[model samples]
Target: MFNVELTSERIARERLETRRKREAERQERIFKEKVRTIGVDVKALDMQVEEKKARKGAYVLLKADAEDRRYNFEACVHQNRQKKKSREMEKALVNYRHQHQMPSTRREFDLNDPDCYRKLDPGDAQMMLPGLAGEEQDSKSRLKRQKEQLREWLLCQQKELRQGKLRKKRVIKGMMAHSSMPWTWCLVCVPARTGESPPRACNRSFSSRSTRSRRRR
Candidate 1:
């Protein structure tokens, strides 16, 4: 009876474990169907993940290519600099050799080379003018005539100024002589209480004196 009971218990436990595994599988299928009903495709998600991985791989290749190109460019620049330095050193050596007269035939400078100057105008580059002497004589005569005219003008201006001054001096002298006479305008505006006579008294006296002087003459 104990051995029979043990076999029965073992069989019941096996049955329960089998039911649990079946229920878990059933729940997983139901959840997958619900996700499909909502339009979530697992295949498309897998493709997107694959594309992202591909893009990451391409970016890494591109970065490597860029690094390689940069290193190549740096190498080329270094080579070019070495070539330039070598050329400069060669040029300096040649110049030093030329200055030391290592070569017997030295280059000579040519002054008469036609390439040194611009082309000359044929019409304007003719010989000296034949009438140069005659033109010089004419210019000299013209200058002398101009000098004479200028001198005459200055003389006329001086003579006019001298005559004007003489006329002004004579007028001033006449005015001074008339001022001592009592009948002048100098005494007319002055006060009568002064030593000088008034205008009316001096006029009558001068008129009478003029008649007397006229009779005596």
Candidate 2:
């Protein structure tokens, strides 16, 4: 009976010591600097930060991909538009050529036509003689009209020449009247026209005036 009691007491003491050691270890872990600083799971927070960064990187990649796709779509649309415009221009050119460039409508078509001689009118031969007579008459009338035009042109030129001469005479008369000079003054000044020298009296008057002006100065 004594041995049984001793064994039971020893076992109870060992269980109490193990409970205190476990409590001490739990308190040490709870109060450690790494756990006490934030009072939360550090590894869990780090994993959350990593996950956030990965999500942001993925979003950036998606945005870049979307932008590239949009650019490609717009470029494709522009290329298609250019092709359509080119096709339209070619179509318009073809239509214009078809409408205005027919072979039968060309000026040289008659030369190439095999039936040109057969298509000639029967009356064209008979009209040829009269046409020659009419052409002769037309030539005579044209010559007469040309002669009349030449006469009129000559008369107009002569009248213009006479009017020009009269204008020159009037200008000379005006100059003489404005200067209060006589025809002798004109003849003296215009030696090329009259081939004469100035008179003695005119020379004397001009010398006297020059002397008076020099004395005044």
Candidate 3:
């Protein structure tokens, strides 16, 4: 009876050992599966972050390009304004000198008149001078600059209008070319497909003769 009890106890211990090993194996498999899932999640999150950064970078570049274009346009407008103002000032100087130095054709005035600079107000002459400071002077300069800009803008507008005419001519020429025989001539374009025999070439002379006859009429 002791031997039988010992055998039964040994068998029970073996079954418990097997159950423990199976449970351990199941826990290991679950841990490995969790690790794999976490790794995939991390990779996906990294990809999403990289894509967001790329999009942000692209947005920044596009904004910078637009700002640069606007800056260039503004600079062009400013330079054009200064050039116009300088021209107007030069013209005014010339007219004032001509009136003072040369005798008028309609009325006889002394060519060597000493009152040439006297006719203009002290403030006006000072404003025309290189450097001066006052609120009124600042206002005048701003007005003058604006007037100069207006003239510059007008000249630019005129130039653009003239160029538009040239552009129209070019478009008309292009239209004529498109409507004419060379553009109208149909090309027998046959793409050679893979694993297929190419189509036979058509007679070029016969096709050209037909086109020529149509054009002549």
Please name the candidate that would achieve the greatest TM-score relative to the true structure.
2
Query: Poorest 10 consecutive residues of model 1 by lDDT?
Result: 185-194
TM-score pick, better of 1 and 3: 1
Q: Which has the higher TM-score value, candidate number 1 or candidate number 2?
A: 2
Write one digit per residue (lDDT tens) for candidate 1, span 1-217: 5545588799999999999999988778778865334557789999999999999999999999999999999999999999999999999999998888653433542355454345457665656777754567477889999999999999999999997677656555654565555333332344333334435544323443464479799
Q: List model 3 lDDT by residue over 142-191, tens digit each.
A: 99999999999999999989976775565545444655443332233222
Most accurate candidate by lDDT: 2
What's the lDDT for residue 114 in model 3?
61
lDDT of model 1, residue 117: 41
Query: In candidate 2, what are the lDDT values of residues 1-217, reduced to their tens digit?
Result: 5545688899999999999999998887778866544457789999999999999999999999999999999999999999999999999999998999877789999999887767888766343455544456577889999999999999999999997677657655754565543323433343332234445565424343454469799
Off by over 4 Å in 1: 1-4, 31-49, 52-60, 63-67, 74-78, 97-217
Query: TM-score of each candidate?
Result: 0.31, 0.36, 0.29
Better of 1 and 2 by lDDT: 2
The order by descending TM-score is 2, 1, 3
Q: Which residue runs of candidate 3 sit more than 4 Å off their true CA positions?
A: 1-40, 102-217
Q: After superposition, how far is residue 36 of candidate 1 from its true place, in Å?
A: 7.6
